[model samples]
Target: MIDTNQFLAQMQEVLEIEDRTLSPDEKFRELPEWSSLAYLSTIAMIDDEYNVIISAADFRELQTLGDIVRAISERQP
Candidate 1:
């Protein structure tokens, strides 16, 4: 099972965000550091950590960190 707190921390590392903590309701795209590279890094991080492959299009549809967690949970066996 994936813990939300741990996942948030990992996302912080993957996104190279050093100054602030991520929240479940936070709109990641609104972050100042958000960019194409960050998007790709997020996809890679999800794949490596959860074994779930989320496409760029699908990823774009996700609005918040909690949305991502729910997507992964629904896709898991």
Candidate 2:
């Protein structure tokens, strides 16, 4: 199972944020580091770290850090 800590670390790595807990209700739009480049980085990060290839549509649809965790957890190896 993909724990929340792992999710946070991955998010921090992709979004270039300090490692921290992102509450489920926290909107990603509040993060200035979030952008097209960050999303691309996130896609690569997830692929490299988890061997999960996330679609661009999926990436665009994600709203919060928890949304990403849920998406990644739903992916098959």
Query: What lDDT does the true structure give each of the candidates?
Result: 0.86, 0.77
Model 2 poorest ten-residue lDDT run: 17-26
Worst 10 residues of 1 by lDDT: 51-60
* TM per prediction: 0.89, 0.80
Q: How many residue pairs clash in each candidate?
A: 0, 0
- Give the top-scoring candidate (TM-score): 1
lDDT (Cα) of model 1: 0.86
For 1-77, candidate 2 gives per-residue lDDT tens digits of 57878778767777766756566666776788878777778788888888888787777787887887888889947
Positional deviation of 44 in candidate 1, in angstroms?
Answer: 0.6
lDDT of 2 at 5: 82
Please state every model's RMSD to the true fold in angstroms.
1.3, 2.0
